[model samples]
Target: MKGLTIQQMAIGDSATFTKTVSESDVYQFAGITGDFNPAHINEEYAKDTVFKTRIAHGMLSAGFISTVLGTRLPGPGTIYLRQELKFLAPVRIGDTITAKAEITGLVLEKNRVTLRTTCTNQEGVLVVDGEALMSPPKA
Candidate 1:
């Protein structure tokens, strides 16, 4: 797949990816990661928690940011360098989430790009926020 080189990107350039979280998605993530936290897999057990119901794993939302970077912004062949995330809200099953990434800075000498990343639910509630550093494909 073709990717944007560092020179082809500019500050404020952005992209987004959206998906509806599903029960199957949760289970698959849990199985792959071996994270069976009751808050994610056990609805009955989650009733006792602050969320009052099972919530999708925070990493699942973070993956959406990856999707935007890997498939859209810097596109394919981008090398992820670093990421910092803050979980701002819960993501429940069936919530449609839109993950967005916007170019914030670029280091042309190093072929690096800095991005502001975020994910928002259907209700426009911010669920996740972060920054990412990446190496765009060679020009």
Candidate 2:
């Protein structure tokens, strides 16, 4: 287990996870989450939308942030408390997305940490940005 105790984290501690979005990835996310939004699953319908083509579900990319939080930084036993996100750009099939979480604040008394979370695509365009509150594993 990669759990990091609250004492082991600092204001700048960070971690990242990346993956290339694929058609299969999108469909799998749709099936699991029951999102099935046309913007994500229907190419022809997407063509008429502002994206002009199919785009991956925003939450699918957001989930990458969870990967970083749960498996990398304050890893394993970290408890996710809250998150606020802003979707800035569309993620297309084959776009490699890198999700990062950097510690920004800590509440020692509550054993909580605040992280600046973000996801960027292959073109360096920010696709998602957010803040997350979590509880690091006990020492």
Candidate 3:
């Protein structure tokens, strides 16, 4: 797809993408973020938690939305201005998460776009819900 500029997008435009969660992904994210919470890395410790298994970090799921906006829909050169996120459910290893975004508002003069964001698991359960404001390239 061609790169999107601020003037080229409109309210109600949308995009979707999916990814499968893996143990390695969780570990790597833990390493990078220094968030080595046992519930996210140790199965035995997770077994005692409410989830009963290791779960991906909430930010990891949110990253999927960022991935779509920065690399696929609006594409390279897009600038993220703001984001509001709510973590609704745990994302377990082996679950396939689908991240979706729909433009809710656009301020052409300011070059800002607001999007309704959601990430759901294969079971159709929402894992994350949020809004993101971005500035796509103008030229």
lDDT of 2 by residue, 37-137 (tens): 99999999999999899999999999999999999988999999999999999999999999999999989999999999999999999999999999989
Q: Give the lDDT ranking, best first.
A: 1, 2, 3
Q: Which ten residues in a row have the lowest lDDT in candidate 1?
A: 1-10
How do the residues 55-137 of candidate 3 rate in per-residue lDDT, one tens digit apiece? 99999999999988888667788888888999999999999999998889888888888899999999999999999988888
Off by over 4 Å in 2: none
Model 2, residue 60: C-alpha shift (Å): 0.3
Q: TM-scores of all models?
A: 0.99, 0.98, 0.95
Off by over 4 Å in 3: none
Cα-lDDT of candidate 2: 0.95
Steric collisions counted per model = 0, 0, 0
Error of 3 at 107 (Å): 0.5
Cα lDDT tens digits, model 1, 1-139, are 8789998999999999999999999999999999999999999999999999999999999999999999999999999999999999999999999999999999999899999999999999999999999999996
Answer with 2 or 3, whichever has the higher TM-score.
Answer: 2
Local distance difference test, each candidate: 0.97, 0.95, 0.90
> Model 3: clashing residue pairs?
none
**Better structure of 1 and 3 per TM-score:** 1
